[model samples]
Target chain A: MTAAPTIFLPEVPDGDDVGLAPSISRFELERFICGELPPERRAVIDRALAADPALKALHDDVVAADRAFLIEQPPLPFFQRPAKAPSWWAGLLSHWHAGLGAAAAAAAVVVVVVVATPDESNRTKGGVEGPRVSFFVKEESAARLGHAGEELKAGDQIQLAVKDVDKKALVVVGVDGAGSVTVYASESVQGGLSKGAGSPRVLPASLVLDETTGPERFFVVYGDDVDTLLQAVDSAARHLGDDVKAGRADLARTDQLPLGAAFPQSSVHIVKIR
Target chain B: MSISQMKDQELLTGLYRTHGGRVYARCFYLLRNKEEAQDALHEVFIKVHKNLAGFRNEASPLTWMTRIATNHCLNVLRAKRAPWHEKYKQEVDVGVAASVAGGGGAGFSLLENRELLRLCLAKVATTDGSLAELATYAFVDDMKQADICVLVGMSAPTLRKRLREFITICRAEIEAHVPGVVFAPAPI
Candidate 1:
């Protein structure tokens, strides 16, 4: 398995660790609702809650909400793709900042992390002019999206694309807002302990536009930190750059999951051709 | 072929006959509406036909169709912001609530606990990260963390971390809004 980009996570501060990390994504509470999670796992969670009264209170809320989601839902006319899905085609991407102008864009755009050590030798200082990278982030279950979309700020919409994200093994893009984009998927990017290396993840990026750089539009990538997220995105984009278009061809492989070597349908990727 | 010209309207009909009950049950779980579930049934079939051209010969047509059903139901939830639905309260086994509230699942009277908390959840789900709202649903239903991980694409460890954060927010939010519950200090 290929190694993951080394990221130093912060140590759990004293008084914060209750035998487990407290920080969690909304995704975990949702798995229980869909019947997707197993039983023993729930036991562990329950026992864990016995230690945290706060967790128990929150657990009660989750239980109520899950039941609510299972109730009759209102009419949703918008979730379906517009008759024709939007074109998520390939393109040259670059980073920009607030001070950047149209004139600066003509120079090769490189959405570098002002926070990154700026070791120009390893990464492209010039985004379009530099060598290619691969990156893609996927939000898997979205069990809570229906209710969550309400909180999405207008600027929160993070737009990312490559000719073919699936083609490459790794790719990276940059963000300006620093915390606007979040790479979401059902599994962790570094879930290497369980799955094999090279598992796909939707990585995030951000930027600080300036006189020499920055594109016309601005973006803010959030969730994971910007510099680290950008590094991972660069990796995935680079990896998949080869087969973004060809990647769709393998939508043929979803059947492999259930049928030993051949699973049945591959629905998510089919609709995500870029 | 046009929608009108397809012949396995017979097979479609037959599949519906044999599996419609089960499939509708799945749709109801997400949609929570009988009519909407019925309407979604039509759309699911249209989707089945549209994608049938690319259907690989791997899984049985039934398995493939069921997957399409599940995906479509999720889509329906997404398209509609999971609007509130009319609920039939008697069916769900109220769990500990039965012991505490002396009523069936709906009858459980933690009104003291549930009333203010439910409102806080509504506020956060509608405002903060909707992930919290989704988390509330799964946790209450007692879903495993792994299932939530698979469905939402978040790491399990990371998810565990998030559930804790959201709970803190919920408790504080409830205490501030509700009259009796003692709220924990918000995590910085």
Candidate 2:
């Protein structure tokens, strides 16, 4: 079968008559649906929708499309699927930067990739390890420090800031969730960060969380060489849950991390979801 | 009770209750296949379970999930191109041919019609640079212009201009692919 013909866009003329309905642009309608329009403009579209059944039908169609587009797939048992990031998720983050110029600047930052040893003598009440690496999540606007077990709500813009991180170290970040493990960011995988790049700093971009975002433990693996460190990251990325379930994945374990090994040096930071 | 205090299963149940329908719909439309869509939905819920606690509430949960589902499905499509999409395409083609015949693809469910619609929307990416991303946000994701602006880091005027161009191109493409399908919203 022949491939469908590609649609080529014509050069859009300035003030081109794009055949929109009178007094209502497509932008206005979309914004109206999202409740982003001003009250006066919203009232104008409201009158338009009320006056014209065709316009109302169009409105209904968009809503219907939105609904139709959201067909949920059936659920499966969590253990049925591997606990690794789907192959596509790696490219998923790159999609956000495809046409989004400078939007990366707005993304949440990873201030430090802390790798610490677990000390049973210093274990906390909730099974949290005594934080080997000191990290802070400070609300950008309020400058309020987020404690290790503090609750953060939606709309909270935080910077994951770290102090005294190794300048030559590579940072690997991975999330161990209820069902799957995903490596959302890695300084080594992404590209090695210089000392300045790896310095203690608040993620310049704001952090946003959601309701299904459960308590997460971010594992920050530090290494001297990007490639050498990432070998362990790749191993971790591939076997995030396998080793974790056996408790063998713990970086603090002497077996997991032989002291002075180029790889296996990392810290785990756990954030409580409230 | 605090949301944080809820069990993992309970938290997922609540999220599924609130956004499940939309998340499922978005997955089905993008994947255009029942089984894969179902798989995508489960993956989305898992990600939600992992990420929801840190949700910043800037956008509604529905919006957040829709964004998640969109990217997830796109990834699914991108990974296995040959057999998966080819089979899906043939199915959609048969459905379209049936629709043209007068039954309006009665054999193909209404869900198929919407799936076919998204299939055409996905084609908008093939046209040229930037249009694919723009089309995804505007038509597939139904994002607001203001949010699109922040997302793409384009000025309002640039965003509007490109979107208008996008509308014109997508309408022509969708119409060509699915004759008489009124899936494209009327502009203005």
Candidate 3:
């Protein structure tokens, strides 16, 4: 049989070399940077980098790229169990309906707004200031602001809006009476939720109250890192345990969620009458 | 934080700092779009974070990460139903014409021409996905047979057979794209 026709191709570049000149493998360089390498191995790489300008250049380029990435996407904070609310605050929460009524009468608004007491740890850490969520109920075609402990019917459409916070990412999760969780709104891969400067920003989507009867709490988790925000919300949900899921627990009076001080959080609590 | 927790944090931070760029580069190389690559980069890191414990034992964490990136991108390409070969049909035709006219024989360097490389990869990709992955290390990364064996966990003979199959598919694809152009199988 005749020999197969030769296909002309350039020599395969050595996998270990970064650029034109030969050097150590990229993995070795990375290990060096990470301080994972043994001292002797580190010395070898150091000498190689020192001797080869091309290797040094590659190292610098990698460092700069990682630096830019870190700047754009910062590291997530460590998880921490949230502190318990004071006994006095818990006592005040027991008279939540009376408090809500007084506040509503003072404002002369149809909606009763219940805002979570900001976590003191967050405040002490100088977290985002005045991060507040407003609840709105839809009646017919017109939507009105919603208030805390309002009797909402099944299938009533409601929405949430945020004001006085400038964060790169936001996630809103709802824990219904049945303890089933729903994500109302979240940041997209392209970027965070779109908002106008210094204006109350309504989320793009609205929620229709489910048939589950009892308290429905919406938690707003906001931070610069979307991944961390999601993790925090998930961790908090896990911490709520079976009591909330069994509909035996009132989330509003429950201790704050176990989110780090870095994430500014707020919540709106409403009751489903049906 | 506990001492163990602190160490875990440092390890994760170091991993991100050291290999994040290379991972991004690998993602961009395969996906060929900045936005898609960015999405893939985040996804790959999530996998890395989840598998962080296993990384310390890995002989070559970069290779392990590359495998993850390749698999993820291939899945994406499959999900999008993007015909990678069809997208670069015009480029292949033009390159073939240039090579024939210039009397450069019947072959060209695969890595030197990225469009052709992508076209070959698309043609070689199959339901198994291993063949395309093998082709990437063999052709794109230019890894040695021994290294490819270790990276992919295949015997040398199996690798040769799979590569031969990959070449057969690529040859058929090139002929189909540019009629009258017959490629001689290059040595693996």
Candidate 4:
């Protein structure tokens, strides 16, 4: 009636040629799986995997082992994940890094942490406040001029400029991450994409030009037209149920509204540096 | 999907739909017991939904969740050692032994082979130098490499070296303990 002795052991395989264990890391393996590694490395590994059955078997085991570990592990909490962008991700913005694992996928959630952790002012993701726009013009005083633009009511006349027109420009306005409103514009607006019908089409007015705009020198008309454009922008932008609270719709100004440059007047461009 | 195409709400919905189950399943694997996994999964999802706004293209969501799940399961495991895992281990062994002993009955059919395979695996699992607890956590639960890497911080090279040694230990222990059960020793 003695209690059975505990534990069972298996027979060791007959060969001693298992070789030194692989040196690749779980991260590198992930990069490999993600196709993040260079083509050469992938080619080499693919060849290796195809050539040796044992190696291929080990590779499958390795992948399976990873999968099993993932299955057993709880989905890690994404809320309080890392803040700074991983170097690899920040480096390659074009590539959509996806399905890597809970760790790599968790990158989406950590993004929240990173964005919030900044803005020393502890800005909450509160409801939309009114648009607070700032026009980073080529001049210094113009920077502060935007404060006035926010207070501009309808019928107020102001002059602004026409920035580069891309097929579909990525504009940044009121908000940073959430403010890219691609507006299709008229043919007259430099590189305007879509326009016609004997007259020009109204651009999605609030469009913010990219850095390559070079602070292009031109003028814009602000009055009933500007107000109408702004309203249209606000409406179209929030159409997707965003209720976008524009910070400030900055309209770049140069001088009195243009009264047709060809009116027997001048080609002389003058900034009243008063 | 294009960023412009999916509205925020749609994106949020997609996040839940795609990742919810696997995440929960993983929790179950970590806990190895049912309720604990469920609880952990609930907590993570709630946190994710609440904090979706702050995402700023930082660390990927996968990394984020692994850290959370890793911390959560580890917390649960550390909190109560013998409760969940021990009970599970006992039940599994008993179930296997009974089925094998049962007169080649219904439950003994498919599970029979699976049980044998699992028992063999368990035996193999023991040979690693890891304590029964550490070994319990290192299961192959169908995670991607990144996820597994997060769970086990030690690099692949390190794991390879240690796993071989650990497997050897388990094999020796099994051979010494189980009188005549001849089985192939897993790689050490």
Candidate 5:
């Protein structure tokens, strides 16, 4: 009988224990576990969990915790609901404070003009020459938007383009009309846009103004702090009344507020849809 | 006031009607305790009302509300206790070691996969930082291999090798907890 040849395989390398990648943030993990990731991204996590026992186990626990809470809690009562800013009527204060010289600027230029360069102090100490922000409206068959306010009608598609947001800032966006104000985008610049790294930031979804839509005011505030801007909007909305109009001056007015102290270099653009 | 803004309060009321139940459920789930969850319900709804205008409907309203609820609860928990990362990691390490030592083979309900999975990942994170990083990026962050490699600073061959090792460990753990649940051998 021939002796069987013996083959030896070396022990599998356990791999070097370098620290985690900076890009894989704790927030990202929470979002994944909570099912907040889009389908394509979610699949990536699903595959990894499937192949890795430890990750699968961790995912299981997160799922379990979520399930436990869902199972144990009772429905909340209506009266228990917290106070919120009214949605429909454009607050007069918000309309009044919509921009710096908003009323005047809005009256002067019926068309929206995007300011490419922000105030020097507002610019990062040595940041890349800021991102160019433009508004586009889908009119007729083509998406035509030369400036901020260029005649928008019912069912018109509204989109915003932010160029060169090299990942240093955040973008907060909202639409305030006589009826209601809607925040379209607010988050880190990376999340607000749909393009790849180094691409111009564009709103992920195209907003279509419905039939009831009237003189909708769009404001794009570019800076570092989203929460602060949100608070400012809240404060402005609270004191506002129904008569406040959407003017370019209201948009410019934001740059002069104490809130602008934190976002000195921030660009606030307002567009009115009629 | 414009028509839409006029309906803002009504819109919020409508939102409560549609999503209040699920929001409370999510708050309780993360908070674990009832009282904390209840407080979170009010805080979360207020946040919802303020941000309601910004919601672009890119995601379902329920999903948005759930996120808000979860964030509120997480913040509350963070404020009340020690850092979750350190606490969870320390506890997870000990549990993972015990499980791997051939002692955790008792019958666990297949339905308890979520709890088991959480326990197992904590252990994995402690034992192998590289593996843990890979698992987090791949499973938690859901980054593609190319992106992960760039982020982790690993070559394709090295990443592939590390991934294989991670899978083997994970599979073993699964088999230990629930026999035949993963990678069952084919019949002869």
Candidate 6:
């Protein structure tokens, strides 16, 4: 075999000649800002910033950018996995049900009443004495009942609890800022809603608000036929049309669906701010 | 103390408050798009959160996060499938020509120019992903070889060998793109 072909190679300059760009790295600046750097390193950065107007400007930019981001996108409940109901709450529920006779402790009985007294703070929009729906917001590891027409931002996590309604199926839907109607929580059209009779029981799954800005209206309807209720809600939403979908008109107008007096319905609306 | 002790939400919020700007800036620099940088920032932090336990005191938090962001952005660029050499053909050609005109066969150093460094990274990544990563620390970050060894968890000899392999690939790429252009043997 012929001799191996000679490979040509380029000459690399000496370390001294290699011109590494003279500038403060973003990483260094971040560590300095967060107090992660040693005092000596901080001094180095301080001197550099003082010596270079560009570096000073960059430092200011970094601070302002972080501030704006924090203000605009504060950590919301949806960012973390939905926390389970506290163990104390579960223990209390078990104890209360154990104390009451099995006959008196029907699954349909409102457990929320035993856990916490009902107040205006626990109610959603159009809070009434009889069968109704309420909303709760989880924040800072605590779940608080949401106020009527609460102003929430994108990424906020919310749970809906229904109370005092005896029905085979329950359907919950929301008209979002885009005016599109979505079924928030419900069972299959044929199966109806899950846990229809339990008063003040939270519906399964927490809803993380989407990045749409405007009014979002939610409707809770409970009845025997899930399909009919869905149809009625869909028809009413379509009737509301572009004005409601575009968020130009209020979603409350669809509160009185053609489903008539047969099915009980309640509505709550929230303003989504940027 | 390890970052693992912090709760997920608290850690995430703290990371965002402290280093989000720098990560976003790094992503934007690499990707050259504001929206893609924002998306990359969120993805990088999610990775940071997942790998929080692996964080050591040897590397500063920002240094570790920068490595993740750089790698993530490089992968994004690699996934784009755009021919980086072709994308920066004019700039590379002009740079090579200028370097050659200076005579003495000083050779062209891709490390000096960010665009050229990106082109080399994109080209080298196709053949060897790890080598491309090593090349990034050597060239883009201007990290010392010894520091690179510590950062990449490679011994000095291994780091040198991999870097040589990376430089070889980069040379071939440049030769293929700008025929007859000489390259300075990169200082490892």
C-alpha RMSD (angstroms) for model 2: 18.7
Which ranges in model 4 have alpha carbons more than 4 Å from their true place?
A1-274, B1-13, B32-34, B46-60, B98-157, B164-183, B186-188
At residue B91, what lDDT does model 5 achieve? Answer: 52
TM-scores of chain A across candidates: 0.19, 0.40, 0.49, 0.21, 0.41, 0.50
Query: For each candidate, what is the lDDT?
Result: 0.33, 0.47, 0.58, 0.34, 0.45, 0.58
**Model 2: how far is A246 from its true place, Å?**
27
Residue A99: error of model 4 in Å?
Answer: 28
Per-candidate DockQ vs. reference: 0.02, 0.05, 0.20, 0.06, 0.04, 0.07
Stretches off by above 4 angstroms in model 5 are A1-128, A139-142, A164-171, A175-181, A189-198, A212-215, A223-225, A236-258, A264-274, B1-188
Best by DockQ: 3
- Judging by DockQ, tell me the better candidate of 2 and 3: 3
Number of clashes in every candidate structure? 88, 30, 5, 58, 51, 5
Top candidate when judged by lDDT against the true structure: 3
Better of 3 and 6 by lDDT: 3
User: Against the true structure, what is model 4's DockQ?
Assistant: 0.06
Docking class of 1: incorrect
lDDT of 3 at A247: 57
Model 4: CAPRI class? incorrect
**Candidate 5: deviation at residue B186, Å?**
8.7
For each candidate, give its TM-score against the true structure.
0.27, 0.38, 0.47, 0.33, 0.31, 0.48
Candidate 3 - chain A - TM: 0.49
lDDT of 6: 0.58
Model 3 ranges with Cα > 4 A deviation: A1-7, A10-274, B1-11, B82-85, B88-108, B178-188
lDDT score, candidate 4, position B122: 45
lDDT of 1 by residue, A67-94 (tens): 4432322111111112232111111112
User: Model 3 chain B, poorest ten-residue lDDT window?
Assistant: B1-10
